[model samples]
Target: MRFPWGPGDVADLPTVGAGVDTLSDLSRSAEPPGVRLRTARAQARAFRAEFALTGTPDTVVTCDLVTLPYPTRFGLFRASRAIAPFLSITNRMLVIRWRDSDGRPRVLLFEPSDVELGRYTPYFDNLARKTPGVLERRMVREHGTVLGHLARLGIRPDDVDYLMFDHLHTQDLRRWLGTTAHQDDLDARPRAAFPRAKVVVQRDELAGMAELHPLQRPWYQPDTYRDVPPEAFLPIDGSIVLGPGVAVVKTPGHVFGNQSLVVNTSTGIWVSSENVIAAEALTPEHSRLPGIAKWARGWQQEVVLNANTIETTADQYNSAVLEKTLADRSQADPRFLQFFPSSELTGAWTNPGTTPTFSHGHITHGVQPV
Candidate 1:
């Protein structure tokens, strides 16, 4: 099948051109004057329209999963820090393909990361200093880089159409978004992995990173995207449909501007987020939350905060509940609520095969591949 992105190899994928160029220029700022208020309102309304539609995808969308190995602290995934102290998690990125609103083949990549890159590996850098030999040990057992993992699944650096991170924690977007206006290739700096892809990020999320709060600054690696040109991003406020069955919704809790992607797969509506590590942990009740989430009740705790708890404790609780409501509840026997963890953290303890392996479907044709 041909794609409107262009014919032949993905290198031919067109840039976000003149027709859609206004997208990059659109401001999602929420200041005193709010110059872009009308545009922001239009986005909000578009999201509401899609939210109300509530139906299966217009086309059978498919998502190909690849988990790039990364070390994770056990204290983060669960509320209990006493049990397992650390875990082996992968930075899971999904390449979702479907027909867009324009009836053309489209692709969306979620949580793109190459931890081996100097900018993206600051977390490991800290670990090396604090624990010593920790990163080296993990690297020895690690699988491969993000690009390498994608290649194993038949995707290359140029294959991606859109790059979206759940939240930029320890990410170096320049590695994927490509560096802009840099003339010297000999500068020893990395370029964008997906030159044809436009980055999808929340307005506030990008703004917050420009000058991060000391609390959440540890996980952030701003050097990655600090120099990125404004035109490379497609910033949005609230939720809006990206294509037929895919939408990025605002589900802030893990971070102030955190978001989640909702996809209508063959199984059901699958949501990818960093709000909660595992779907099982989000034990739902009759219109209420259970387990550790209930403990956060009075404080409005819904699910255990993943890592960057920030000042959104109550917000995280509410967002967790909201995420649960969006999950597919078609199963009863250890319910397979189509909720996916953006990080490989869950695979470490819950299911190992999913660590650097696939959880479902195929890259070419997902669940109902023909």
Candidate 2:
């Protein structure tokens, strides 16, 4: 719970206010707002960890570094704002260039988006959820610090071995898997932004994040796995297959191990997840996607568990009706199929290209680094 942001935790604000010039950082206070997960024997033991979509995916490459512009809350997702009051979600910090069934070179990063992992108004300030500065000036005019957004795709952070996440809400992972208590004090701790990465989660989400159920620990940062050990954690109790098209689709009820990643691109089979918000909310036909599906009426489509962490509405509606095949029918630009969402993408930010749903390119000026 102690995570405000640095290499994974480094704060130094206080420059002044209309953007305040700077400082005034104050962070991590929302440790309560749960929706489900108390017992049905822990929802039938997280509904026996299921995963679908097999074979036909031995090719890929993709990068959509950043596209954030958020607002229109149903607490932040469930198709937020329904039809507008401002909404633009696209925090796509991705990078995948696959091959590994012995084919090697599997450099990956499922959810790389983190501009100093923006505090997002102390996580909805316990739901008063309003905006005067507009998500802190679009997160300081739009993010940077994900190790310099992976050095603008030229890649680094130990050339990234594998770092996945479809859950671990305001994530931190000790900066990137480098805290075996104190790796012989490498300059004062918190290091490993990638260092040959190996962080594949979902052993029932590290046992439901070691029992953090006080209403899902305010979207959790769980001190970024605090002392991070136990062989640095590779734990997978459901969907496996890390290469030859890359797979990680546990698809649990959004939190007790919510996984989704099935890259096999050229515009096909690209399923990544923040738990089905758009892609038409994985079609049961008509959820054109918008928030407060509270419990979705009439023909029941609101599997809206926007990280509602443990609701288990029929296991998040069978993981949003099997996340419409994570990606296998192809189409990344217009028809909106490659289902990607680690954050910032609820409805083309403001009806830009207008279709079923759309987001494109992803890169915006200045470019800072440290």
Candidate 3:
């Protein structure tokens, strides 16, 4: 199939290829924001071990699996699984990790769980209400598969040092609330399973979240928001550095406070935690339908704060252009690869052959075995 966006259209821009060679240059670029070293070797070993387990040593990693779901529509005329003539749901998490020059490790994480509705039959109940059921099942299956694979790789849970929450969506909040409410309930079992690592969120993001929705104020734990000391926050025009090696760039048009993480890994600069668009959306050749573009843009604004800030202007413009270009194409016309970093790649033992590799723009070689 001819992709709406493909090579030759924007030859000057980078083309993401396979293996370490493609990643070499980009990896060597300036490190990402929010990373500083107090302990070097300890961090390096942790990073290397995590990369070996996850399989994405230099790029973003997405958790969960993509699969078909039942269709329906909920409030605001949105298509829910119940409304779909047929439906499918695919969910995943965004993961990032890096190893310092000496092999110390740093990690970043994002939540990508969503109940996608399709096929149009118009179910009466709100689709969001039913989404948890679908998501719960998917998470259970995915978590089991991921854990088993990691265990075989000799990676234990304690190895992780950072867990970034991209944003707390309704689904995520629901899961947390449910878990806290019934810590012992069998159905609520998933709540107690968060990774035992430092849970991090942007200080401004946490504050904005509280201001936007008062009710949610109680949802977050007091300790969840750790403001990077003033010295740690970088103030670039389009981006803000959170720490020594970690920078959070505003990539709006997806969600308010939608940001991306730039980290320095052993390989090079890894742009992980992108929230402006899906992995395919960033590729020069792909395009999105007009309706989807409008919906996505609107959704981002409605969900996040400071939606119109200048930081996201470029991303917003680019995403809008792509959406218009592919307005006529069906969703399947585009090969959508969800964005992920090197950390979550650890869950790929189930399909050893199809596993992804990391590289800078020049390399197209296959990934090295962990």
User: Which candidate gets the maximum lDDT versus the true structure?
Assistant: 1
> What is the C-alpha lDDT profile of model 2 across 249-365, one tens digit per residue?
566766657777765443444566777545544432343444333335543653444444554445555554455533434343344455555653434434432223344333221
Instruction: List, residue by residue over 1-370, the lDDT tens digit for candidate 1.
Output: 1111211222322223112121212223334323443443454344434454544444333332333234333323334322334544444667676765567766677776655554335555666566536644543344455676566556666766788888877776665665555524227455766777888776677667666677776787765554555566776665667766677777665777788877765556677787766554455221122223334444443455566445455455555555666666534333435567775343444223223222322212264323
Candidate 3 lDDT over 165-258, as tens digits, reads 4444332322212222332323443432224444444334433443434433332232221221212111122233333344443333333444
Off by over 4 Å in 2: 1-95, 98-106, 111-158, 161-164, 169-176, 180-214, 218-264, 268-271, 277-281, 286-307, 310-337, 340-370
Ranking by lDDT: 1, 2, 3
Determine which window of 10 residues in candidate 1 has minimal summed lDDT: 1-10
**Which should have the higher lDDT, number 2 or number 3?**
2
Better of 2 and 3 by TM-score: 3
TM-score per candidate, in order? Answer: 0.69, 0.30, 0.41
Assess candidate 2 and give its lDDT: 0.50
Which pairs clash inside model 1?
A: 176-193, 178-192, 296-301, 297-300
Worst 10 residues of 2 by lDDT: 16-25
- How big is the positional error of residue 159 in model 3, measured in Å on the Cα after superposition? 0.6
Q: Against the hidden true structure, what lDDT does model 3 obtain?
A: 0.32
Candidate 2 clashes: the total is 20
